[model samples]
Target: MTAQALPPVVDAETWQRRLDELRAREKQATRQLDAVAARRRRMPMVEMPGYTLEGEEGPVELADVFGDKSQLIVYHHMWFPGEKWQCPGCTGFTSQFTRLGFLDGYDARFVVVTQGPIDEALTYKRRVGNRMTWYSTANSPFGAAVGAPAGGGFAVNVFLRDGRKVYRTWHTDGRGTEQLGHTFGLIDVLPYGRQEQWQDSPEGWPQSPTYSRWAGSEDIAARYGPDGGTA
Candidate 1:
């Protein structure tokens, strides 16, 4: 299909009427999402053991991750030991939350957890210019419990701290994690809609392979030194 064969242009009155119809559905969807979130808040919680993780300050316990806060949000990053680079999808997802300082005002702490070596994790952190806290879950049960395991996948885990004990309050994976990045949400409203072959775009709309071209740029690759150091 060609660009000239795209959807026909309509008059202003027709366009507004169609947009209004879509807006009504959008509002309904928003309310439905809010109702689902309310139900999520009422779900049962699971006790999380004192799992150890390597932090910038050395080995730290899961409770320590909260850092005087009552709630903790962990991004289960997919970086395995011995991999030359971290997962690009995980990196992009994390890059969206680097400046989430507002969570502090609501008594919440967020951190990225990975199974990679501490040194390599730090190097990737610098290369991506991340300002958020990152910890290595190497040799820890945190990854498996959170659904990321030792291979490659992304997940978000929420926890609540009571006194010295920590409990997993909620968790989400798959498309549920899409809410973390504005890029996906924003593109979702566009006419082309992510330009991915899987989307239900119009006949003539453009589409490409999804997430198959995320290799780090040349400048970013240069940040890693000969010894795999981000100096």
Candidate 2:
């Protein structure tokens, strides 16, 4: 049988020296993130048109999704018109966020917006163990207006509301939204660092196809349903 690979062992001094060098680079990356956040804070936003959306409680307007909060963070979940399950990647990524109510501390609220019909979206939401309420944009132009049109993929869109007026402050899709999911960050810190085929790793390191870790997330999602789990 083939033996498992591992990082090379080194003396205490050597390990400490190497770790210190990596820590310096890690600190620099942290500062760069801080700089980027400063720029995002100053970014210009576009005014969004008022539109109606279908909520679990029936029809509601753009500002209504924010509840009483001035800030709204919407996860645009990719939906298939007649599929039993929506995008597995989106399902797994979003279901991990079981505790978003804490956003209230920042005067913000989080919710899921999907392009499918209300009934279908809600069913999928429960089936995938989603905690956030799902709203349907099937009849609203808002989804497309925000760059998350049906069948186009998923997105993370941030909006701000002043009275009844709404503005989009930021939008991220593709790899740009990766940081929002905790799984990747946690995995990246492990010795294997995702062990994905696309990553740059030393020879003899374990590796597999990109995003092949969905099964692990499926276990997480399964625990979110009504049967047996706490947020």
Candidate 3:
């Protein structure tokens, strides 16, 4: 489908009034999000067992991932055993989180874990120029415990360390994982707003087959690679 013409021009006063109305809603949404976060902080945590995963240097325990920090966030990347490539959706989500040195400042660490072979994961990491730590749980039950079993979907898991013990504080999947990507946040502000068929845009606005059209495009893979090159 093609893009529709721009919205009709309106006077500055009308524009300002419309923006002010939306700004109120935005503020309300922000407060609602803050409330959710507050509740998340209070959620009870489960103790995590001594699980081992394969890293670049070899097998490593789950607690080791936290480094000297007390917090860890792991992206359960969906990479099934024997698959030639990792999940594109996971890659897209991770592409937004490569520069994670800032998390160190907060005494936190982030890592990507998959069920695929460690060598394969490393190859993809190098090809995509990922800077965050990565590990493979192919020989462990880490993926299943985190709701990302073999051939399963993506998830983000948060953990807290108390001395030598580790506890799972929170986990989220599906739309909840969207917080990791800025693209959707950026798209929501556009005039056409993602241009997805499901969006409630005005009549004649461009619309396409949601994520399928964008994910199936070769350009997306190319764009995710180094220097805008193909992966």
TM-score of each: 0.89, 0.93, 0.91
Q: Which stretches of candidate 2 lie over 4 Å from their true place?
A: 1-3, 216-221, 227-231
- Clash numbers, per candidate: 0, 0, 0
**Top TM-score prediction, candidate number:** 2
lDDT of 3: 0.82
Candidate 1 residue lDDT tens string, 1-231: 455336668999999999999999999999999999899889999998889899988999889989989999899888756665666677766766647889879999989988887778887787666667899888787889778788858899999999989999888898898876787887787766677777787787878788644435223345333333344
In candidate 3, the residue pairs with backbone N, CA or C atoms under 3 Å apart (3 or more residues apart, or in different chains) clash, namely none
Q: lDDT tens digits, residues 80-199, model 3?
A: 565545567777677677577888789999899988889988877766656668999999998898788988888999999999899999999998998767978998898888888998
Models sorted by lDDT, best on top:
2, 3, 1
lDDT of each: 0.79, 0.85, 0.82
Q: Which residue pairs come into collision in candidate 2? A: none
Question: What's the residue-level lDDT of 112 in candidate 1?
Answer: 90
lDDT per residue (tens digit) for residues 141-188 in model 2: 899999999788899999999999999999999988897878889988
With a 3 Å backbone cut-off (N, CA, C), the pairs that clash in candidate 1 are none
> Lowest summed-lDDT stretch of 10 residues in model 3?
212-221
**Per-residue error (Å), model 2, residue 32:** 0.5
